[model samples]
Target: MSVEAELIAPAELGTSVVSDKGESIAPQAKEAASGLLDQGDAMTSLAQQAPSVVERMQDFLLVGGPVVWILLGFSIIALSIVLVKLWQFALLRPESNRDVTQALALWRAGEHGQATVVLKRNRPVSELVYIAMRGVLNVRQDMDLLKDELERVAALRLNQLRALLRPLEVIATLSPLLGLLGTVLGMITAFQRMEAAGNQVDPSVLSGGIWQALLTTAVGLAVAIPVVVIHSWLERKVERVAAVMSDSVTQVFTGQQISVVAEPELEELKRAA
Candidate 1:
């Protein structure tokens, strides 16, 4: 009867074979329509269930206790930071060592401008290398000053790379201690309850508090271990970038120093000619 059903009915009935005994095609058409209706209902039901599932998760977090909830928050933050670092390295870190080597060769061959142009076009160059290449081209006599500037830039960018890592370090160190504190407090509460119910000492009271203590401790360890590993991995990556920056920039400026020293000698020989 509906517009959708009318349209679908013709397409479905064309595929279906009617009995030679003159069976009605109406039931088969209705069956096809019912299948479409069932699909729509299934989608509707899934949409309705989504919010209920979110509600259940919220309820679970609420019951996870403060220490557990704080650890949960740390876990999410750590995961996000790790993903960002991984993405950063994948984009910035080069797969081949030839980028720096080729650029160095260009600069040493009296093509200083061309070397910079090459570096600019290279997609996987480090930020440190890029900054150094831009600043060091005009540098001739002040190799010491250039070194100072490069060191300063390297330090600043290295710190930026290490930015979110400190929080992960803090989380790693604090989680286990928080778990222990929760366990101690839980034990204290359990004993107090036991003392108050001295004559009627229920086994449930003792066992229940102990389990809560264990749960908090377990959550803390779970949070701390992964946080520590992720922090270490990120720190290693930052260090590697720092080394590449330092080595590449040093190679470029070392050649520049040679050029500066030879410029005066070349000019003196020209006067003698």
Candidate 2:
């Protein structure tokens, strides 16, 4: 009778089984199903949160987008200037200092033709040497006149060098001022909102306004700092160019053994004649 009772209980359990395999569902399978349901709920919650994330991003852009654009414009201009200046300086570096020295020596030895040939043969440095040679040709024996002419040429070159750089300086000076303007505008907006909100001003609204105002200042500095650094570096380059000009002119003048001659004696001699 006990064996018969056990067999009946087994038959009842089999009848209760609803699994595809015709067996009771396993404990691990039940736990896995619960885990899947929890995962789905988490995904749904995350999906609900996505719109808030998008709103925050939109708000950030609405507040800071213009400042970012302005910074981008300035950066483009600055980078362009930097690249151009780098190219110009690289091209203008003295290619053959030794050739220039040899040319000076030849000119000092009274071999003016050979010196000119030396100047013509070399590249780039030749341009500088040629300028000095022209002054030598024009102000032949008058060192002061030659020096003055060489200085004039250098001044012209300097002007050319600084032509494009002026815009950079102007932009650098104006960027901060523009930032300040943006700050002021942002403040006005914030105050207007405060007035509109009246007694119900939210902290979030005020914080947003303040952040927007600060963006302009940050943008200004971002534009200004690099511009100043680039300007300073360019100014040094100009100074070095000036020094090179001076050195070249000096070499030519000294090589010719030329001195400024007083014209008073020549004028007296002409009068006597």
Candidate 3:
């Protein structure tokens, strides 16, 4: 009887352990399933909302009329120009200082070959520096003529940077004016409708028209403000590049002049001695 009781107790202990593990695993499984369901629900809600958001934007644009469409075009153009200019600046690296400084130092040290190699980068400033160094060493041209050539090249480079800027300025200037025109036209149409309605004039109708008319001005200003700021910022960048080019080129010439003067003075001193 005692042996049988011990064997039965062992079986009961094993059963209790299995039951406890099962209870713990069941809650964990339920939690995992609930979390997956929550994620699926969120994804489904976002998918549904996406189309509605797009529809709202389309409706808003339609309500703003032709003027808004034109503004949208201008905004696209401005964005494209901005992207293109950014790409150009990145490729050209107009503000690169380290290589320019190194090249200038090499030039001043009379390592003309090394200076030319250092200025081999495909940058406007580097090009100008190389040309100046070459003109002094190889061309042996008069300083004045070389300076003139440098000036011309600098102008050409600056003009390249200034490209597409006029269109941006035009867009900024014309946007607000176009919006005002749209508002005027819209108001006139609303008034004509009110006159046609005579004594049955609805304030809601007038209010809707006025708001729609104002929408053009709002869109126009939105397009113009950022464009103006961007145009100014780009102009500043170009100006800075111009300054760097001028400074670097001037330093090269100035170093040449000092060397030239030193040579004559050194010869004169030797003769006097």
Q: What lDDT does each candidate get?
A: 0.76, 0.75, 0.90
Error of 3 at 44 (Å): 2.6
RMSD of 1: 10.0
Clash list (residue pairs), candidate 1: none
| Candidate 3 runs further than 4 Å off | 1-30, 262-273
Which candidate number would show the highest TM-score if scored against the true structure?
A: 3
Q: What is the Cα-based lDDT of residue 132 in candidate 1?
A: 64
Candidate 2 lDDT by residue in tens digits, 17-36: 65534444577678899999
Error of 1 at 63 (Å): 5.3
| Predicted structure with the largest lDDT when compared to the true one | 3
RMSD to truth, every model: 10.0, 12.7, 3.7
Tens-digit lDDT string for candidate 1 (110-212)? 7877777666443333444556666676546375776687688777767767878898899999999998987887788889999999899999999987877
Q: After superposition, which runs of candidate 2 have C-alpha atoms over 4 Å from their true positions?
A: 1-61, 65-68, 94-98, 105-114, 120-126, 134-149, 258-273
Q: What are the runs in model 1 whose C-alpha is more than 4 Å off?
A: 1-64, 94-97, 108-111, 121-141, 256-273
lDDT of 3 at 255: 80
lDDT of 3 by residue, 1-273 (tens): 699999999999999999999999999999999999999999999999999999987976898888888999999999999999999988888887788899888887778789889775578888999889888886658878888999999999999998999999999999999889888888988898899999999998899889888888988999999999999999999999999999999888888778668888999999999
Total backbone collisions, model 3: 0
